[model samples]
Target: MNRKLWTLLIPVVILGLAALVYRQAPRFPQEGSAAVIFARDMRLHHAQAAELSLHLLERPVSKEVRLLAGDILVTQEAQIGQMGGWLDIWGLPFSGRQAPMAGMNRLSMGMATDAQVNSLDTLSPRQAEIQYLRLMIQHHRGGVLMAGQGLKSGVPQVEVLAQAIVNSQTAEISLMAGMLRQRGAAVAVGLPGGSMNGMPMKP
Candidate 1:
């Protein structure tokens, strides 16, 4: 009833209303948001990795290579589904208007070119295994980089998935490198150098 009390009460009422509105606000990634871009691009990236794994599986390869391919196929497919689900939840189209991996080099993304993909079909079993290993290693490197960018998006879901990709793929990269050495081959060169956690990519 007093003037001073009324002024303090008015401020408290305004603060309460603001807090209520904030709590009800919808939270989601916008079209141009980093999370959206990461989801869209990473889905395509995972699709390619899965397809490459399938190609390798169709051939007669070593047991180790066969098992690795199967793992990659399953993991990438699951991740693709996860990212696609996020896009749907955000009410975004599966694909975006911008070119895939926009603002980043395709090689940086470790994507196999049309020619490279076609080349797999022409290789003998042994040759296919070697080619697939090299390509997938490079591809994982690219995924690491993209996922690193995703981590910077400040979206909780994006950061969690991005970190998961970084951890799993980085470990897989090491495994595949060993596989390459066993075959007397080396990882393909000339790709960018960076880890998913903003560090230099490990050899």
Candidate 2:
């Protein structure tokens, strides 16, 4: 074949392959519905809460703090079960395709990154407590944003769950804020429920 003809054929072949790939891709989130988005996102949120809670449970802490952490673990575990159950009811996997509303959006309730999780797992008891507090604050912030997004997105599928998430996370946010303050650690936020509380934003 002539060089020019070969070049033209390459483009056509590439386009055909691309089309096939696109067609084969899973129809994720089925329009990114609430049932889809919430199940997908909340799984991460709840997992982190459980992680931090489990860490605290394993650590020796002041009675007050330990008690609080214990409560968080139990409550969040129940909530996690509920969300996972929702996925089963919907005939969706516990984690589904990213919804359009949240596909590009990073969930604020997203728990620790792999590195952060690894660090938490490796730390000593005292350090674990501190890191748990910080990572959890970030995780909660992510949750708050998602819950708020769910509420704002008008997706009826996950609205009730999202609202429940907001209510629960808001309360936990306040609790963590107080925990940060009681530790004499100055956080950066002004609101109790806002994750910025008692910590400085990175410059």
Candidate 3:
């Protein structure tokens, strides 16, 4: 084929393949299925994680905290994009008609309240590191919880993503714990209802 003809055919071929894949993809989750709930709520939860990490990055903090903040920002932003893609592919709205985490037993997913979020701005550099570590520990644990729920979804892709969350966030939590101790702050206690094993009890 001529170069001009090849260029015209390339785009058409790509779109045709994409449409074929979409049609052959597994059946989409129903409105209240674990897949939909996890996608919607986890995206919101990850947005907060990325936002809080950005706040930490803007301040003068320890080298460890800065590195951790940058990692969180990048990682959670990617996760948010992945979950958003899932929602789009499934033909679901990004926000659900029911409340956030509605199918997940109304768990707040350990989100920081407005007061807690606002407090980051007023803290000293070292204090900010401590606070961010504490809040992120809670946030990550919440991710483990949500991801645990995803394991019951029976969707191979969703289960794989959830298991990855369980693995990665559990390790991050341990690292954050060590960092907190280095900063002379105790590790956060009373993590929401779960041991550090990343398995959440079903509500």
Candidate 4:
């Protein structure tokens, strides 16, 4: 009788332990959660920024621009890691079901098309610097928009990362604008509704 009671109690204890472990596991984000969306999209976005920075490093440019490119390369690559790690932790795929920027405003702001990115390989050093600076400034603006969206996520970790992107990129935008001015290149105009320094761009 004692043996029979012990067998039944063993299974009950095992079941309770399983339930406790499941309860303690981290919760995965929903498919459409802001954290998931930001992680997926921003990983791809930061990858592009990393590529552009590498291109700039290979080109002949002023020390100022080189320093800026170095900074972007390090910062964005780390951010890519952060976002990718979040996706892995959440058990989500690297790419999402939705199209890129499907739900975001100012869709064209930061992204460089394949053609634009590929063309950088063929440009002269001076031309590459100018083109890269122009494209990056635009890209940074788009990033700020996405990061702003991330800040609205209720998840504390996601909001912290998003806010960091906003602060860093906003300052970089001003820095890039100054770089463009030093080189006598025109600042890349923002999208119709987008603005530098948070003011709306004029038509």
Worst 10 residues of 3 by lDDT: 194-203
Which lDDT tens digits does candidate 2 get at residues 94-132? Answer: 654543234433433344566776775678766666677
Pairs with steric clashes in candidate 3: none
Which runs of model 2 end up more than 4 angstroms from their true locations? 1-31, 97-110, 121-124, 152-157, 190-203
lDDT, model 3, position 33: 89
Question: Candidate 3 regions off by >4 Å?
Answer: 1-25, 103-108, 192-203
Better by lDDT, candidate 2 or 1: 1
Tell me the TM-score of each prediction against the true structure. Answer: 0.83, 0.65, 0.79, 0.80
Could you tell me the TM-score of candidate 4?
0.80
Candidate 1 shows a clash count of: 0
The candidate that wins on TM-score is 1
Off by over 4 Å in 4: 1-25, 99-107, 192-203
Tens-place lDDT digits, model 3, residues 103-165: 443224767777777778889988998999998888887888778767998888888988988
Every candidate's CA RMSD: 4.4, 12.3, 9.0, 3.7
Local error of candidate 4 at residue 49 (angstroms): 0.8
Model 2 compared with the native: what TM-score? 0.65
